[model samples]
Target chain A: MAQTFSASELKQIYDFALDLGRRAGRILIEGVEKRTGDVGEREEGGVGGGQREKMNAVDIVTQTDLDVEAFVKGEIERVYPGHKFIGEETYSAGSSKEYLIDASPTWVVDPLDGTVNYTHLFPMFCVSIAFVLNHVPIIGVIYQPLLDTTYSSLVGYGAWQDDGKVGGKRKRLPLVNGPKAVLPREAPKGCIFSCEWGKDRRDTAGGNMWRKVDSFVNMAAEIGGRGGKGGMVHGMRSLGSATLDLAYIAAGSFDIWWEGGCWEWDVAAGIAILREAGGLITTANPPANPETDPIEEVRLGSRLYLAIRPAGDSEGETGRQAQERVVRETWKRVRALDYARPGA
Target chain B: MAQTFSASELKQIYDFALDLGRRAGRILIEGVEKRTGDVGEREEGGVGGGQREKMNAVDIVTQTDLDVEAFVKGEIERVYPGHKFIGEETYSAGSSKEYLIDASPTWVVDPLDGTVNYTHLFPMFCVSIAFVLNHVPIIGVIYQPLLDTTYSSLVGYGAWQDDGKVGGKRKRLPLVNGPKAVLPREAPKGCIFSCEWGKDRRDTAGGNMWRKVDSFVNMAAEIGGRGGKGGMVHGMRSLGSATLDLAYIAAGSFDIWWEGGCWEWDVAAGIAILREAGGLITTANPPANPETDPIEEVRLGSRLYLAIRPAGDSEGETGRQAQERVVRETWKRVRALDYARPGA
Candidate 1:
């Protein structure tokens, strides 16, 4: 059983989590540099004897991952003695989707969200931590140690960024760091978007791999679907970090992010931060009939999400209206992908 | 005829260019922030009176790009009055491919290399500068303003990075800031590669856009054309900046980069820096007969480049040999794209 904590109690946990995240980030940064030149294990000789763990050919894991998960779990356990937990490292075999469906007040964590990138010394990975109440992500914190940046928030509170000394400023989310967003209704022509080429390259029919190929072609095609001309958005990028991709959208650095096949841990913390920043997160495909399929039925494990950055009133339409138009337009382009919640 | 100078004279130019890059970077950073929150012009309202120029839906020009180009050109003219120049903003309209064929000592400049990225306020853009002597890049400097990182080198001299305060280090390339390179024979599986979905989405039979789709599928396929099964490499990324992409390869931050359709200005500086770092730059597709084709003939504007980071003898083979093996293997995977030099 999980204990029901008051808002004040949750805030305390949130504060502790942020500090824990920064310390964990330091550990990750140190480990990352060590692995950069250590690619020998897979080839001929490697950096003497570094331990390399692979959950799959493309999905890699490392000692740092296990160490970080242990640290986060230990810290949470020490503070909230009765809380339930779901984490990437401790995830039981064959139960990838089982743990995330419950309505408990559990801590969902992906101590290292972009392991492949981390192994390659790429700088886009993050440590994602979230507190979910009755299946809702209520508190979230994501820290990218290499860049010394953090994105955090509580459900009803706002999201914030502590962008270390180089940037030299603390900021609210939807980062006022750049120009206000310009989202045109014809997405492919006016917006910059992001998606991932996930590791699962099982190319069977209905297997996620072929769908990605089709999406890339359709999105970049000179023409749109079935007889319609394409929206021809500005561009698409695959930066390899799910946590940062979500956080970037939340910060309004990107216009939209559409992805499929990432699990709950990949999105739990980000959903909280994104929502707090006034962004919208929807299933990659819209409800077949808006009146018949309620948006409330969308779940984290649905494995497909289309996120949009919030706009300000300066762009002619209200921010919400702009977000809706972009989403509706984008949804039309992606009608081929089916990401409906497993049973709903 | 163009003036020929001693190595010392080139060094002076290199030092000057580095300083110029820093100054230009400061100007870009200033302009970038001003444009943030200024996207109102396209829709209804916008950031008050700031000029926004769009060469196309995907290519944008800002006052800063023009200002930086003029600043660079003026400073060069003041110091070296007779040098010829080729720049993105001033490329005498309609002759994009005409200027690079000559052998004059010219200053090739891409004042803003990733304009679309800059316009979207994405952080992958850079200021790329190179001094080409008789079609050979002799001095190069690339500065990424937002990150405050500078990558520079003179041909035959080594590549170096002034990583600024955030990194608090000055170092030689392949960034012995970490481990030495470890390249494996199975290119895709061992290396993290990068390319671009460039704005030229022509979809014609011999066009660039459709080839990207074919290459992505072939590279990520479970099996190859030859009898062997597929080589599923770690992953591919599209970071949106051709200049930085090559610079990162020079720094050994990424293992391989295969790209086409970028111009001389886009690659000249990076080519010089990469060569200085002891990396290999080859055409994306191998010659019909490697025994008869000389690698040295690969040019800056051939527009199809396949680059790999050099490795150390500690990794079983020498860096050059490792580069050859990976390139050979990767070349086998990409038979769909035709990037043979136009008259070679």
Candidate 2:
């Protein structure tokens, strides 16, 4: 029953969504500094008076996330009333099996991507919205309000960043002093890498994930040449926010971020920005016998991610090769972990 | 004999040292980023031209660190003339017990605190400068230039933060925005907690840390919770820089961070900041015999660490008691590994 929109309409629609996303971000910023000192009713979120919606048992979902999502969903519905939609906490009840198995256009959203941080009052979460067409993600926008950074792209506009500044002084991002000057380079060991724990409570993939992370630490410090004892990894860091993690990579804050078990909504926006910054996103664990084109299957919630910064001072191929090496190392690390002793 | 001076003279000495530290930081930042991204060079830091000065295998001593120390030493001579100085990379050159071993007022500096991060281009590193009064750190200033975060304190006067903003004014921080707000009355099953790699790279400690992290995840989503599957650790993050890690604890971004194998200098400034932010810093692994003292033991390089936000959120008398139950549960998780087997 949804009406299909043209390409120009789609860009305009996404642009509108970005506006609402920024507004929501501002509200969150104001609320975080307010509700986060000493004590407040925001804790024990309840259905009753003074209580906000609490996600799961511990995460405190504030009016901010709810308010933000409502505003976001409203704008989407208003512009494209007939389009199919899905959201994190609220959309589940109305979700159908068709979206997963069908070939229709659908919109997926995680308004406040890092919900726990939002609830606990940590500041790095983001607003993620993606448009999928015929089962392929074609339009995405990842906006992190706190840092005032935005990543967005339409199938071929190429990826770029817009400093989420107020008003419309949209500056095309990566403010690269030069284009094509950037390239992917070898991932330096002894640097911080980012990862997360997906909703899988059972320790199935948890154990394996830990092994991979542990090996990453060793590799980073081992390369640093610390005598007494230190992994080549300089240090390992998990910032608790996907949007910011990718932004940092774009800005050259953290060297590499290998992660898994995240949804497309979580990465859609950042993907655009990372790409704009000249980074590559690949599968962390592609099968040894991959299908004809395994790259086509990479999706959010697929439990695999490897993103490397496109080096700023080298040839493009160098950057491409560097990212590939990191991908291979991540796999090797995984394999090493697989063969590691049971106790490990 | 080492000369001693008044606080005013010490202030001048510190200023001079700070200048040297900044110069060293700039050198490191440039090398890590612009030089070349080589994981091998990172892992095996050999002598290189332009800003790099390699030491022996398992260790790297950049010219920046040495130059900074020399500048600091010269300034110290200019200000206090004979103040004793001891540095990490320079310790081996002398056997004189008078500097490190003997109890004398000394300036202990980790020119590059997170050296591996420096080598690998990871941003979780710092310049640690602690003025030890007779081997006890009295005045501490840990500067993370890349992030423009400066944590400084002189015992009596409270701690402060100078945002990474180069030209920005110094801000009296905890930004208090201080202390974590108390959890809502009915807290969720699992909350976000952070754990990190200890200097001890043993499989047992490594396995134990993961078990503890897993316990938090399982506790969060414990089945029957909305949006949670039994394990729901909001998120796990590691920034690689101990200085930054501890600083985040002080800043309240991290709810809890458990670490091991760090020194007094590594924590002194942040511990003060964490306490100022109303957070608790305790032993990650409780001693067989519990002690209720605010500070304990001469075992920093060997023991584990546990830093919790809002210092006194839990009603229990000790951090050990708060996390003790989880520790027991973690034992079984480690059983699969021989190093973690009983009666090692």
Candidate 3:
């Protein structure tokens, strides 16, 4: 039998996660400020000092990442006692190379998503916290300090965004309040596409990197280019933060977000929010044969994922059908990428 | 002989530009809100209505864009009666397609950049204004309404940013105050690169679009991939806005911004801010030969531009030399693109 969470219990967890995410956000902001010399004494400079400074910036990110993870872990353990926790930093520091997600209530966290953006002071990093029960994320919170925005969601409950203004209202997700958002007539052609170039940059023949580049070009090319594979999406955006990418999709700003080579923690919180906001998450690649292979729901452990925004009725199709249509159209334009988890 | 303005006069102009930018920003915000149904009544829905709704959204952007241009042009002409004006919408609406930039004191403006982002409510659009004297931008203002931030600069004066806080202190450009910033040891490696895929989606062989796609791959691939043509940059970000891209380079968050298929109004303001912040702007492509063709300064009319962030002394080289080295290294990895202006 599975353990069930009540609505009130989930609300408590959501509040806790929101609080924890904001606290973690402060640490990230402070780390960036310290690194950029916004709040502390300046570091001494010398000839050939660029390398040292670069190392120092990396150190700040690492330290802040560790600090946020430790703080969140400690708080969760103290409050929830026996709940399990899996964090990016902790997992990387552990000796065990393999792990499993069983029937356990667990917390998955990316203490600092977009570390590169953090180091560069690009203002797109965030703290993402997700509570999973039996391999399903039920509670999510993602806080962006620089933007002062908070996105939160609970299973069976709708997602919400706090715009971080004094006395500001917390708006429901899919932000189009009353009416349902209708997909563009041509779908992907008028859609805003968002994707990230992850850490893997290897470009071997038919490698993941090659597939990504090819797919991006295909999507941005003219409608008749590349033998009709061109999508000619309204825009292509890479914000370097998968968390924000998913959040934006949930907000209905980004029409689609496809990504590969991201860890579970990077997408867990975002998945919870996206699903609750009426968005869909599926495999990044399409079925090998539509006549035979059915589209699969992306698992938490899947290294590749595709997210589509919430849609309303369009062309005699329901919202779900519209989303599926978009997914299929997008899949047709992109090459399938292979990204296996370590020791999977 | 030419007319030269005094420092005090330039300061007055900068202040006026900043004020005008903020006002234009408000109009942009209102337009976005109105289109998103945040500020106005909802529209009636119908079956298969996606195309009509999209047209409505595009109408909002066009109306807002024209409104901003008209507003800015009116104020500028009223204040500086004898100053010449060239705006994105005005130029497009005029009968003559050819434009000339002589020695006149002129205002060049892109009332709204990133219209696609605006229609999608992606929050990266802005109002850009530049005052050009003798074919050089002397005062620049770029205002981002969604972020409530302003970036302004004047020739012979430093670039500054106001963080849109109540009583927030204005900070200098490069955002690193005390000490100068140093470029990474293997710059282009540890640098954050920003670029845009403009409206030109035509992918002809040996054309600008193909070159851009190839260059992006080289820049994002592993250092040895593509037969050592790879750059392996820290990250590649496409925010879909050239004006903000250049402003970010000036702010030191984005280390490099290489763009093509943009207009004089799109870059004039950003160029002034970047130059004022000790950054460098040159042609997007490299010179023919290291010993022969010298690097040329990017003109206001140069549709292609490459911008590098402000750098301090590094590796026994002065700040300017360090910037030049990064530019050359970046140029080595990217293919030269040709974006000829209409009737050129």
Model 2 residue-pair collision total: 54
> Which model, 2 or 3, shows the larger TM-score?
3
lDDT on C-alpha atoms for all candidate structures = 0.71, 0.52, 0.81
* TM-score (chain A only) for the predictions, listed in order: 0.84, 0.71, 0.91
Interface RMSD of 1: 7.8
lDDT of 3 by residue, A1-344 (tens): 55777889888998899899988998887786665432111233422234223336666778889999999999999999978999999898888745456668899999999887777667678999999998888899999887778889988767877766422446567664223377767868888899888777898877888888888888888898989988889889999999999998987889889998788899999999999888899989878763346667778887789999877674587878888888888888888888867554
lDDT tens digits by residue: candidate 1, B203-232: 565676777766666666564422343556
Which candidate ranks first by lDDT, i.e. highest? 3
TM-score of chain B of each: 0.85, 0.64, 0.91
On DockQ, the leading prediction is 3
Each model's total of backbone clashes:
18, 54, 0
Prediction 2 TM-score vs. true: 0.65
lDDT of 1 by residue, A1-344 (tens): 54477878877888987898888887787574454323321243222122332122122237788888898999889888777878887874344445345777788899998886776556678899998888888899999876677889876556777666335455566653323444565665666778777776665667667777666656665654324635555677888888888998887778888888677888999999988877888887656763344444347777778898856544576667677777776666664464444443
